[model samples]
Target: MIFVNILISFIVIIILQLLGMVILSKMTPFNDMEELNKGNVAVGLVFGGQFLGTAIILGVAAYTNSSIWYMALWFAVGYVCLLLSYWIFDWLTPGIKLSDQLKDGNKAVALLLACVYIGIGFAVSSLII
Candidate 1:
């Protein structure tokens, strides 16, 4: 049963990560893969953060929950929180559009956002148990 739970978690986590990527891509106006392929460091930073953030949440959820379904449920909560943090940060900052700055390769904004995502992941993970 433990092995089965682990296997299910592995599959579900991968699916969740893909879903997060899709949602993120839809949020931005530019093509995510195109930017990454073009060697855009700003996009790389933010995108990397998004990936790591979800990973952190998933790991914590899996660790805390005994059942696979419960783990996925907790993951959903953390994932929603993470997404909210992203949108809230963007909304709070006026004058400049983060998506545009990212496309233009603004490392400063990218770095800040990356840290935000990572930080939120850790913060949310702590509350999981």
Candidate 2:
């Protein structure tokens, strides 16, 4: 029974992560996989940060909740927070458009945005408890 529960949890988490990525891809103007294929480090960094951020929240949600439904609910909350953080970052920088900078291959902008995503993820993960 324990093994089965663990397997189910693993599968659910993977599905949630994929769903998060799909949603993120839709939110962005550029194609993430295509940029990644073109060796765009800026896109890679931001996408990696987004993946890690969502993973952090999913980890917390899985750790704190035994029920899959509750885990899913928390995951949803965490995902929304991550998305909002990106929007907030854009709002904070009124003079520059982050997506445009990223598309232009600005490594510095990518690094800062990645950091912001990870930082907010850590903060939001703490609240999952």
- For model 1, the superposed segments whose C-alpha errors exceed 4 Å read none
Clashes of each: 0, 0
Report, for every candidate in turn, its global Cα lDDT versus the true structure: 0.85, 0.85
**How many steric clashes does model 1 contain?**
0
Clashing pairs in 2: none
Best by TM-score: 2
Which digits, one per residue and each the tens of the lDDT, describe model 1 over residues 1-129? Answer: 768867877898899889888888778899988998999999999988988888898888887776667767766777788789878998999877889999999999999998898898899888887
- List the lowest-lDDT window of 10 residues for candidate 1: 66-75
Position 123, candidate 1: lDDT: 91
The C-alpha TM-scores of every prediction are 0.90, 0.92
